[model samples]
Target: MEKVSFVIDDALAFIVRAPLVTPFRISTGQHDELENVFIRLHASDGACGFGEAAVATHITGETVAETLENLQSAASALRGRRITDPAAVCREFAPAFADNHAALAALEMALLDLSSRVQGIPLYRLFTPIAGQPRLTFKTDITVVIGSVEEARATARRFAQRGFDSFKIKIGKDEEQDLQRVLAVREMAPGCTLILDANMGFSAQRMLAFLDRLDAGGARPLLLEQPVPKQDWEGLAAITAALEGSGTLVCADESVGSLASARRAVETNAVSAINIKFMKSGILEGVEIARLAAANGKRLMLGAMMESALAITASAHFAAGLGCFDFIDLDTTFFLKGDLSRSPYLDDSGRFDLTGAGSGIGVVPELP
Candidate 1:
């Protein structure tokens, strides 16, 4: 076997604005572009690795500027040090900068990438216990932005024709409008898996009413995501209870960020499922959250934060390795203006091909 060789020497981050295919809106806010931060780490052995993060003002209220500052402070500790234990590097930094999740995510990703390169294996191989065969690809669900009934139908039809079997519809603008959006998509693709993302815009009563309307209309959604505000655990639990046995799963999105939040959600039974994102939970923390969710008998799904290929691929590898995600929302690369990495692109079926050439985030492209 080849010997492992890696010593941290330099770390840097750069900003890029990746335009979206369409304006994505939720209850909190919307954006037409992703303010992304790209991280690069150089080792003493003349090898390098890459990581990226998408800073969202509405979700985490973290901007590229803020993430950059935190990245500088967080990554500085790794310089002149040899990274023999990537996971330990992340675990050690967890408590000091618990608030800087996006920064921590980027930094953790860089360390994992560096580790993968040194070991001459894929990033997921370094994950928990390592999968027996190391699954390297996964299908992603395409998201339909909040829009009129016609736009919803059009979006569903477009992706359906491209062989996508799952579609996530953005809702929560208004009760009646939200109902119509779901109906439009269901009518267009009745066989496809459907997810309605409210982004914490609904009240408990409103959620129940909408579920009633959905039942009346025969449009069974795969799940309802973040129907109430993040802090209102009572409301989330109420909605989840109301929808129990109704075939519609309630998923927690914003309520889960760090392990603390994940534990609270699990202990309180806030929802039947969770939408895990590396943007909120760092690479290490995200996996831990998934383990916690599974242990609690809660279904798990994976999502992204307007990331480019580097970050999206990293996340896909994480979820695919664990092999437990029931839903996937890592299709941000479909909205990106250009490819950030080679062959991390999704297939025609909307599945990410994580088995790409090169190591360390799979061959970074020419910085698009």
Candidate 2:
């Protein structure tokens, strides 16, 4: 095997407009737009890999300034390291730059992209069982962030009209208002599957009451994501219990931060599924989480952090290879004005094809 190494070849950041038609609040207030960050890694052998840092201040406590600082620190560490294994690079630098999950994720993705290229295999094939299953197709939930019932209903109608069959609504603004929003969307798009993401904005009492209302209304949610804060394991258990056998699955997104968290969530039966975001846990850790979820009889969902096409397409490849994710939320690229890379993933009927081969993710468009 050739000795693997990485050089801090180039780094750049750009601001993009990710405007939401609604206010987009849950625990926090309105967010008009999101700041996006992208990173590039060039190997000594003329191979390059890409990653993204897409974040919101309310979601992961990462702002544009802090994310940039973390990237700079990672870039500095990459100046002269002889990285024989990309995973080792992550293991070494992750602790040094702890708490910056977004930054760590970017570097880890770039390394995986480069490493896969070196091996001439897709990143998903490296991890998943590829024997009997056809290449996976990903379908992400279209989000209707906090908004009026009318606006939320309108958003859901638009997305459903655009071939999206799954919908994720941001709730926890108010119990009654959330109910109204969900009801409106259900009424507008009767055939679309719905999931509620509270974003850690509810208490145990609020969650139970809200579930009661949803049950009474006959609106069966596919899953309830992060109904309580990450620290409130007991609350999550309560929520899970209340919805058990009701056909409403519970998923943990914010609560399952690492492999350890995944194990704990399983041990405690906190959720029925896990939402794996490569931006939140890096590729290796994300894979580990998926394995843990599968071992525990829990399903997996590949979620994104509002990334550009480069990052989202990379995730699409990963999701395609996994073959175990019950759902997908890799549509972050749809919100971008223009992606830097060409050959982005496209699904005319809400079904994406991941037949590309070789490493460094097969869909990277040439940068002009």
Q: lDDT of each model, Cα atoms only?
A: 0.79, 0.73
Worst 10 residues of 2 by lDDT: 335-344
Model 2 per-residue lDDT tens digits across residues 1-368: 23454554554443444554334455565455556666666666777777667776677787877777777777766755566777777788788546778777777777777777766777666555422453555666777878789888888788888888888888987778899999988888888888998988899888878878887886778888998988999999988888789888889998987889999999999889899997678777887888788877997888877566667777877777767778887665555444442334556335676665456676554432
Candidate 2, lDDT over the whole model? 0.73
Off by over 4 Å in 1: 1-5, 129-134, 341-345, 355-358, 363-368
Clashing pairs for predicted structure model 2, backbone only: 117-359, 342-365
State candidate 2's TM-score: 0.88
Badly placed stretches (over 4 Å) of model 2 are 1-25, 29-31, 130-135, 340-343, 357-359, 362-368
Each candidate's number of clashing pairs is 0, 2
Which candidate gets the maximum TM-score versus the true structure? 1
Which pairs of residues clash in candidate 1, taking residues 3 or more apart in a chain or in different chains?
A: none
Candidate 1, residue 92: the lDDT equals: 87
TM-score for each candidate, following the candidate numbering: 0.93, 0.88
